[model samples]
Target chain A: MNRLQNLFANKKSNLLSIYFTAGYPELNTTLDIAEALEQAGADFLEIGFPYSDPVADGPTIQQSSEKALENGMTLNVLFEQLQQLRERVNIPVLLMGYINPIVQYGIERFCKKAAEVGVDGVIVPDLPIYEYEKLYADTFKQNNLSNIFLVTPNTSEERIRKIDGLSNSFIYLLSSSSITGSTLNVSTSIEDYYKRIKGMELNNPTIIGFGISNNASYTKACEYANGAIVGSAFVKHLAMDDYLKNIPEFINNIRPRS
Target chain B: MKYGVDEHGYYGDFGGAYIPEMLYPNIEALRAQYLKVLNDDDFKAEFDQLLKDYVGRPSPLYHAKRYSEKYGANIFFKREDLNHTGSHKINNAIGQILLAERLGKKRIIAETGAGQHGVATATVCALKGLECVVYMGEIDMARQAPNVARMKMLGATVVPATSGSKTLKDATNEALRDWIGNPEDTHYIIGSAVGPYPYPEMVAKFQSIISFEAKKQLLEQTGSELPQYVLACVGGGSNAIGMFYNFLDDESVKLIAVEAAGKGVETGHSAATTSLGKEGVLHGTRTILMQTEDGQVVEPYSISAGLDYPGIGPQHAHLFKVNRAEYVSATDDEALNAGLLACQLEGIIPAIESAHALAHLEKMAFKPGDNVVICLSGRGDKDLDTYIKHFGY
Candidate 1:
């Protein structure tokens, strides 16, 4: 069964999802990172497409994105890497980016190519669910791709379920009100949010993202629900290159001690 | 009186599209059809009629006796204050909506800062019975509640943008995002004269009608076609462009643009373009804008909410660089005083947007018989809320 379909069934193990920008430390390292992540025990990996304006990201991810852009990443290059990376990695590789670049890239053509490239899903941070349904819902279903939506703490109960219903896979729960890598800890706020959604009868499962920096932070997130997403910290490690090969040890330090 | 845009869509050096490659096609499409549709005999006749009957134009040019005597100079106010929707925003809104209808665009979207543009857009959309959606910043939505309520009552959806800095620039970004998503059916009703190519040109043309009327009024009053000096405020530089369009080539006339010096130009809180901004690409074209070394857009601050932009219109940029126009900056306190002075002397409330222009008259020597015409852009009723908040009035 699909990861989302499994949630609807009896088994409900907390899923571990990881988000990392494509072409971060060096160009053409996307497939290697994807293979490494899946082996290191990640359930799903969101591949961020670098954008000029990323309003919701924290400082860590923002720096990572800038580095990715500096290394000269483009949509065409990302697509090429994804096309090749998807063949080697079995886990669902979700493409995440802002709407403007994709809109300029041609939505229908992008979806058609995603189908041919082995992308399981796509998450656009800025596109509202209502607009997606009215405009591009068919394109996603046609491309055999799941459209992921996000639910924030400020999101109402009814709105959460509505978005969850629209979202095919688990909804991406934005950890805090601000961007990623913000100094403020999202623990209490995130915990309260997890508890609130736990009772709301969500249409799909939820994965926590943004602000999962260290092992203590990651474990605190896992305790609340599904495996927490580690974006900025991993991107930070990758940016330093020498420490990237040591990611397996980092995962061991964060993963279940067993 | 002539009320048409100039050949190059400039009021001398105050208007032009300074955009980049990404926006070129959209601008080109609009440019190709704008003049043809705006000039169609039927379009002009209907537009002129609406301006007269609905908006109540040819609005009286009232002489501010007390203001003139106090300042030791004559001041004639072009009362756009009596227009139906309360500001010069409606002038462009009415024209653009008419243009959109002519272009066969099904829906219209607008971005507003101080809410004047959105209200005007919503008012026109309601009149035309077309679907309208206005994107505004969450902060603006909160601060400009009355306008938001007005928009909703007019049957336009107000989308509160939560992304970026919650202000006009962010709202514009959101609206642009929407346009990129639904390009086929949407006509972006740009609030001011900044955007990718044709928008800056098209909006300036629609706004040009202001100067066209001012010219006739000034000529009749002074018995001359050219005044010694003409002045207006700059945000996206629309009102100034409108007032300057016909007078661009009138070499005898001096064009002066007043910019917002929120605190001061040296302080970060100023929106004074020529004083601080460098030549850079913003909105659609290359213009003077405040930016970082890496080309990131900086948030602008100003006491006048309308003038809080890091960039100026491309036409203004060219004018500043070519030294064709005289540019001045007014402090926030200066604008407030001018707002009070106009109200006290003329008994006509002007919008804060227009008061920035009024503030500059104090800084210059209006030599006897200089024949200066200052545009009284809009009424102050909508800004009463802001006035009370700012002064505890």
Candidate 2:
């Protein structure tokens, strides 16, 4: 079984997931960040591979991607950095990025590399469900790597069911039909949409992402889904001067107080 | 031959909405409402009226007698240059603005290369009283200062994209990012028959009026509604697609798409998409684009900023693949000379992009009385500096 499946099986609710850009802040900071995030009690970590164009990202994440590229981050460098990652961090790690850079890197090679690096899954927002089904699903399945699909409020029940069928790890329930990093208030419509998805009882689990900032939003999101993944907000902390020391504090702020 | 967009939004193998999930709702809403809104009687009436009154449509299809005498073929110029914003870009702009209004969108965002699309979009937004934001590459804004001023004068905020090559592709990336961020209450009026699904089909249908009017005007001027050959320059291929849409069914008509070969096709500065391109997704659609082995988009070059784009529209890619249209290219020197010849012989100065199609005429062995229609897609007013620089005024 995949590490993602094991993690989800063990944790039923409020599973905290944190997303931070790989090669961000510094070129060699990914391992440190991952170790720090694991120590901070994050259940899962989404390591972003920066691309020149990230359509789904907002200013904060986009800036991180730019900085990562300027810092001479590439697929080879990232893969090399992750060579001994499993030795330090045991939590499930998923690589999140746009499809173009991966496509450039060769999809098969990317999947193989992810598996070799102990990555459990990937979140490519731009790769449509149809594309993955036709071209990459077999490779992912063969490599024992899961690929997460995102759903918006506008996704029809039929498409949602289809996406749920395709997704192995979880369906990323976007809080709203907007990009990441926006200050979002969970409106009644959002709550209603979440309820609708929960009612569907999809085959795979669900995790909410996008516009999830701070403890309140994260807690509110957990009421409706398996858990929540905080990206920009967590990434914002990583950009701070004392990110290594601050990671645990930030995670504790989002996670329930022990 | 089925040439229209399929239900899946594909033009054979080329088109599909490959946007991020964040943009799914916006594109989905657009896909759902575009056809219904287009078919609405009121929508048709207003679109037609705007084309007639504001855009000065039913633009004359003039017989270039001097050009015909010189080239040994009866050439007709579909005067898209006579439109209000000085190109066929205005046709789609007016259509999209009206559609955006009908969709209850409060703000409009667009990306431009040479700034003709920006000017056209800004003009429509000004007329409709919509808040407009236009993303343009820093380099393009500098090169096309006049059109940039025109966009600003029409109350559109022109944001410079400083990333990447600082060209059309980068500007489009910035605009897509903006759209993703502000998905609600903002409609992206893509300037060409490119990007995702509904955009390529929508812009093509809107600009189809160019050929729609040309067919009637050609029948009135000459006895045949179908010309032997129809030629237009391809950048993102909006003007060419607009000129070719109506004639796709006519198997007898030979369609020629001329791409910009900046220095030359082999000089690494050309924008000849079909000649030196591969199938890939760029700006949301799977199209033929100049790309590296690593799939990083190659920066294309041309004297005409409008033709400096690295990719062609997905529909154009489909057409080229299936051999429905012949794709050719012309160099900068050749195009400048052709622009000069058109000015001297036809009393009309064409935009440098349009001159590429005119330059292709020099290579063809046209038979006597061969009825050829060339889409004079834009006027040279905005390209005056480039023309002056080349010809020394």
Candidate 3:
């Protein structure tokens, strides 16, 4: 069975996916955080590859990523961390980043290492669906890494259906108008969009991302998709000095349908 | 012909849909609707009528006899600057504004580089009686004070994008956020062919009338339609695409796309696409964009506000791939000198945007027997501030 079908087949309510930049608290600490989250009741984890200027990201993630970059993070180091963390973690891990480093690292090599390191999917914001299929889609499929794609509110119905049909399995549904960490209350946008898209009747299930934080936003996101992914807020939570100790409490705070 | 970004919207090796989930419905809506309107005969009739009456189509193909005689080269300038609102931006704006009306969108938004497209969008919104908002860079709003006032005068609100480098890219981001919020009532009229699928293709079709006109005018004047070289400046590369569209299949024609090498390529102050950019996704579609190592958008520099971009249209990259068109760059000093010389020699003040094309004449040899037509994209009156700032006599 596909990941989404398996994830939703059992009626365990909507699963919550937490995202935090790897090695964010300090260098060589990614494994501690991953183990903490997995044990603390997280269903999925997203690992961010720090870029110099993340245009789509808001302040919190920008800060964590900058700190990660300053701590001397590179693809080689990220791969090393992932290789180490896979030995310990059991939840499905996804790698999220921009396109430059992967292209520089060579896409096929990146996918091969990702599959070896227990990565289930990959999300590169700058890789267009058409280019993804033409360039990296086959390589990712070859390595058994699902290439997850995003669909914003501005996407037309025809395009949504096209991309939904083209996507390997699941879709990354963005919950807000702006980037992550934006304080914009997008409740109306969310409500209106859910209705608009429910009509398209796409077969692929979705997981919401961006602007999802705390109990309320997470609960609201779960109303539409099979799950919701939190990046900036969780990343900020993990930036704390005692994040490992607080991981169980953090997961408890964001657990859906609590 | 790489045939990338074809009717299907794939730019050969680049250009495709890479968007967030929230935007999926909107993309699908436009994708389904774009083909209907773009192909419909009634829609074509209305679009063509507006092109003729509202935008003043068949814009003059003037022979620059005096300038040609002085340079000893046959010169012709496609007078897109003569269009209503004094630029080629109206061609696309009119088509899109009409499309927005068809979509029943009540509010219109646009992103501007040199404020030309902003002005054009605001003008069309006023005529259509829809609420209009323009997003311009803070730096651009200050430099383009007159266009700002023109937008305000036309009953449109001007919002300055202060984030990032406060340039065209930032302004586009602001406009995009606004669209996401009010997708039902709002329509984003992107000024360039740099956005995601269908947009680059749609904008190119509207602007392609330039090449169609030149083909007819060149045939009438020289008893032949083909030119040795058809040239235009590359600021998001709209005008060059317009001039190159009808001639794409004409193998005898030589197309030259010139970009602003605002100081020089080495100094990191150039918008010269093929010279410095790599294939990547930017502003939505995969195209050649100048970016830093970490995939972060870097600050782009240019003396001319219009050409101050880090990327070019995907089709230009496709042109480079197939070797049908040659790309060139003009430094800041070279373009300004060319802008000044055109005014003094031909009694014509070319927009700084067009001056990049003029600089190409100095670099490339235009034989006396070779036919050369350059698109005078817009008028220089909008660039008086730039001229005075450089040459205060």
Candidate 4:
């Protein structure tokens, strides 16, 4: 089984997944961030493969992606950086990004290379669910990579159920129908949306993401799913001058103290 | 050939909502309500009135006697340049602004290459009393300064996109980012028949009035509802798609889409999408785009900023794939000469983008009575600087 499947099987609730762009702040910082997140008690890690045009990302993540690209990040470079990651980081690691770079790298080649380097799963937000099922699902499964699908409040019940049935790990529950980094308010509408998804009793566990920044929002997100993933907020923390010292503090502030 | 978008939002094997989850609700909302709003009597009434009064539509389909003599054909020009905002762009802009109002959106965001769409969008937003922002390439803003000033004068904020060749593609990227950031209140008025689903289809529908009007006028003048061929220049292919939509099922009326070949199709500096592109997704739709082996989008070049986009609309991709539309290319020199010829022959200064369509006339073998309709998609006032520089006028 994949590390993500194993991680989900072992953990029941509040399983925090931390997302950080692979080469942001500086190049060759990939392994350090991954190892630090695992050591700091993150249940899983999503290493962003930066692309030039990230339509889904808001200002903070977009800026970091731009910097990461400027810092000479590429699929080949990222794969090389993550080669020894398994030696130091025991937690599950996923590569999250747009599909264009992966296609440019060759999808099967990317999946094969990702597996060779110990990547646990992949998250390409723009890859439609139908296209994945028709063209990429078997390739991902053959390479032992779990392809995580995202569900928003606007997703139909039928589509969400389809995604859940195919997912061997967890579904990424987008907190609201907006991009990453915006403030998430757990208003009655959001609470009601959470309850509706929770009531579905999907086979795969859920992990809420998008708009998850601090402990309050993270806690509220975990109330509806298995855990929560923080992206733009954590990316903001990484861009700081003192990120090396603050990575642990940032992780600790979002996840409960172990 | 099959016409219109399929249930999956595809045009043949192209087009779909390949957007991130954050945009799902917005796209879904649009897909669900677009047809309903378009078909609503009130919406139709308002849109029709705006096109007739504000945009001055049923723009003349004038018989070009001098041009017909030069090209050996019965040539007609669908004068989209006569529209109030000076291009066919106003048609889509008016439709989208009305839709945004119906959707309760208070702000409008758009992207522009030559700035025609930006000016039109700003005009509508001003008319509707909505906040407007337009993203334009820094390079395009410099070349198309008059349009930039016009947009600003009409109360639109013009954001210059400075990244990645600083052109139309980059401007579109900046606009997409802005929409992602302000998803709740901002309605992205994509100026072309590109982007994710419902947009390509929606923009085409709004622009379809071009061919619709042409068919009626053709029947009245020539006693035939269809011309022998219809030609228009393709960028993201809004005007071309709009010009071709009403003629798709009419097998007798051949469609020709002209692409900007820059210096030449083989010169490695061109916007000839069908020739240089492969199947890929860019700006949310699956279509043919110029890209490297690793799938990074290649920056395309054309003297006409409006014809410099790297990809055609997805429907055009499908039409090209099925051979329903003949995809041809015209180089910068050829288009410049055609623009000049039109000036001398018809006393009309065609936009350099539209001159691509006019350039295709040089290659065709037309009988004396063969009727041809070319969509004059825009005016040349914005391209006056380019013309002056190129010809040393």
**Model 4 alpha-carbon drift over 4 Å, by segment:** A25-27, A80-88, A153-159, A184-201, A213-224, A237-257, B162-166, B181-184
Q: Who is ahead in lDDT, 3 or 4?
A: 4
True contacts kept of each: 0.00, 0.56, 0.37, 0.57
lDDT of 3: 0.80
Clashes of each: 9, 0, 32, 1
- What would the TM-scores of all predictions be? 0.64, 0.92, 0.87, 0.92
lDDT of 2 by residue, B49-146 (tens): 99999998789999999999999999999999998989999999999999999999999999999999999999999999999999999998888888
Model 1, A65-173: lDDT tens per residue? 7678778777778888877765688877788876655655778988888778877788876565545786689998887788887665656677676777787767777
Docking class of 2: medium
TM-score of chain B, candidates 1 onward in order: 0.93, 0.99, 0.96, 0.99
* For model 1 chain B, the run of ten residues with the poorest summed lDDT: B15-24
lDDT of 3 at B64: 87
Second chain TM-score for model 3: 0.96
- Among these predictions, the greatest TM-score belongs to 2
What DockQ class does candidate 4 belong to?
medium
Question: Which residue ranges in model 3 land beyond 4 Å of their true spot?
Answer: A1-14, A21-36, A50-77, A80-83, A87-90, A99-101, A125-134, A149-211, A216-227, A235-248, A256-258, B1-7, B39-42
Write one digit per residue (lDDT tens) for candidate 2, span A119-203. 9999888888767787889999999998999898878899898888787778899888777898877889999999999999998
- Candidate 2 positional error at B262, Å: 2.1
